[model samples]
Target: MGDRWQVEVDRGVCIGSGMCVNHAPAGFTLDSARQSHPREPETDANEPLLTAAEGCPVEAITITLLTTGEAVFPPEE
Candidate 1:
């Protein structure tokens, strides 16, 4: 099976911080007022989505790999 990664952000926990967007622009973006949601193109397995997740001060990002059911969290500084 092809590999895929799913990303999720907890809106309630999101603090309108743009760190994720800044860290992984290709994988994330902020709304007009800097509200965070998943990016449209989707995140690549090797992309910096993990970094963005770690950059989030609120720890609101979650990444799950579909094929192996593996996951990465809290990007390392």
Candidate 2:
């Protein structure tokens, strides 16, 4: 666990598309609700995680740099 990044899933915004799971199964899973959820919020920063977040059709996944408190995914406004 590098603990440098914070990954989150917005269940309300998730469309249950399973793209995140397909991209990064170790970090994301589709719960019984069929929504994507984080299994390891502070896992080592990786490319798949970013890809998973970016690939979300609904942009439900959010990845933030813990050190800087800056969102790396979903392109924060």
Candidate 3:
């Protein structure tokens, strides 16, 4: 099996830019309040998901290894 990631969006930092949705419409969604959210909190690692996290303007998106809780996006640096 491939790496599985846990995706999260910091609503406090989100600015409703819709960048995530634009990058991965099937992976993310914006709520009525325009807050970013992951369509599936735990999902397989994929290019679109990674792009969505990387493209977030506010760096509100976070991705971690589902099994070990290791940082994926923004890394540990």
Candidate 4:
């Protein structure tokens, strides 16, 4: 099986920048309030998805290895 990731967006941190949606339209969506949400919380580890998480200005998006809960973005220090 391919790598799977658990995606999360912290609405409190999100600034409604829409950067995540621009980076990965298939992986994320913006609500009427402009909060970003993962189309599927558990999804394949795709380039665009990673880009979206990295592109987030506030680092609101987080990606983790679904099976192990290892941080994939804003990697643990």
Candidate 5:
């Protein structure tokens, strides 16, 4: 219903900790076979994808707003 946000995971940096999945199950899922390979779904740009990015222990997830070109980085806190 709104502009979709995209999520990308850098497997080279991911540790398969499952934090992203736990924090935002609707947006991210684990590959299981290759646990570090995170599968992210299309999400509403207004949703909380940034929260999930921050939840990743390895900071592997990146959230990009398709409409505005705005990107959210993981919070330091």
Candidate 6:
């Protein structure tokens, strides 16, 4: 376990592509509306989470370090 992170799925921005679910099923799932949502809001620094975020075609998933408020995935400039 490394830095704690808050995994958030922007349903408004999501396109129900399922890429995140394919990359990290443990972290995300599809809702009844066919939108992607996090199975767990808080999680450790896991590769799957990063992969899920990176795999999102619409870039709707956001992984942020809870402690420092830093955006990890879709990395900030």
Ranking by TM-score: 3, 4, 6, 2, 1, 5
Model 2 stretches astray by more than 4 angstroms: 1-3
Over 1-77, each residue of candidate 3 has an lDDT whose tens digit, in order, gives: 99999999999999999999999999999999999999999999999999999999999999999999999997897
> Which has the greatest lDDT?
3
Sorting all predicted structures by lDDT, with the top scorer first, yields 3, 4, 6, 2, 1, 5
After superposition, candidate 1 runs with Cα above 4 Å error = 1-3, 74-77
lDDT of 6 at 26: 93
Model 1 agreement with the true structure over 1-77: per-residue lDDT tens digits: 44577788888898987898888888777778667888843446755777888789999888777555566664334
Better of 2 and 5 by lDDT: 2
TM-score of 5: 0.71
Error of 2 at 54 (Å): 0.6
Q: Name model 4 segments beyond 4 Å from true.
A: none
True-structure Cα RMSD, model 5: 3.3
Q: Which has the higher lDDT value, candidate number 2 or candidate number 6?
A: 6
Candidate that scores best on TM-score = 3
lDDT minimum window of 10 residues, candidate 2: 1-10
RMSD of each: 3.6, 1.9, 0.5, 0.6, 3.3, 0.9
Give the Å error, residue 67, model 6. Answer: 0.6
Give one digit per residue, the lDDT tens place, for model 2 in 1-77: 46488999989989999999999888898888898888888777899999999999989999999888787887777
Clashing pairs in 5: none
Clashes of each: 0, 0, 0, 0, 0, 0
Please provide, for model 4 over 1-77, each residue's C-alpha lDDT reduced to its tens digit, 9 standing for 90 to 100.
Answer: 89999999999999999998899999989999999999999998999999999889899999999999999998999
TM-score list, all predictions: 0.76, 0.89, 0.98, 0.97, 0.71, 0.95
Better of 2 and 6 by TM-score: 6
